[model samples]
Target: MPLSEYEQRVLEQMERQLSSDDPKLVNTFQGRASHGLRRWVLVSLGALVGLTVLVLGAATSNPLVGVLGFVVMFVSVVFAFSPPRRGGPTGVVGADGEVRRSSPPARPPRSSGLLQRMEERWDRRRDERGR
Candidate 1:
């Protein structure tokens, strides 16, 4: 649910105080990644641990342990399956640092012998008729 106006005011007040008290902590929280390689590696490691636990749980015939292992494995696998982060945008960056997309030429290039021959013939016929 959305925060009430009073609660929002309180939260904003707290945020201001926190920022004033420790700006570095706020920066750290804001800069934390949504996704990246380090995250994938950590999740993979967790998955491995989960697999080990799953095996152990099976050996011990413990339902709770097995369920925990399965849950961890499922979450890790889903998290790890996210698309790789892009290096940068596909567009070229101009000197001004703005991304500029390169467009294809107005006329597409083609080298069909049949088309060339047909054009040549049409031109010759037009010239003959003009004469």
Candidate 2:
């Protein structure tokens, strides 16, 4: 169901807050959000290309077209995953009102096996009992 006027107002307020909180991010997302025609073109083109490739591959009984499709998809994925340029403004706001763009923190390495966890629990229990 469509949102009521009050709900719509609340949603707009939230969007405004988000835009003010991260102008750079909001700018990037805004282009994509309203790019309905562009998105439709991309989807239709992709579907057409995919269908043509599949038909060609089937008719020729050759795997080359299939491999070409896979390669194209893989390249597209790699391009999508590539990190954004650092020259762009960061979304973070500092106390002095400057943009503080920081990369995400690195994750810690995995721990020991489950047996080690069980042993640690058992040791804690034994220490508690002794206390």
Q: What's the count of clashing pairs in each model shown? A: 0, 0
Best by lDDT: 1
TM accuracy, model 2: 0.35
- lDDT string for model 1 (108-130, tens) is 56657898979989999999999
* Tens-digit per-residue lDDT, 1-131, candidate 2: 99999998887777657655666765465344445555455555665676677677768988989767655555544544555443456555444445555565459776598998899899999999999
Which segments of model 1 are wrong by more than 4 Å? 1-35, 84-94, 98-131
lDDT of each: 0.71, 0.64
lDDT of 2: 0.64
Can you give the lDDT of residue 109 in candidate 1? Answer: 62
In candidate 1, which residue pairs get closer than 3 Å at backbone N, Cα or C atoms, i.e. clash?
A: none
Worst 10 residues of 2 by lDDT: 79-88
Task: Give Cα distance to truth, residue 3, candidate 2, Å.
Answer: 23
lDDT of candidate 2 at residue 70, scale 0 to 100: 55
Name the Cα RMSD for model 1.
Answer: 19.5
TM-score between model 1 and native = 0.38
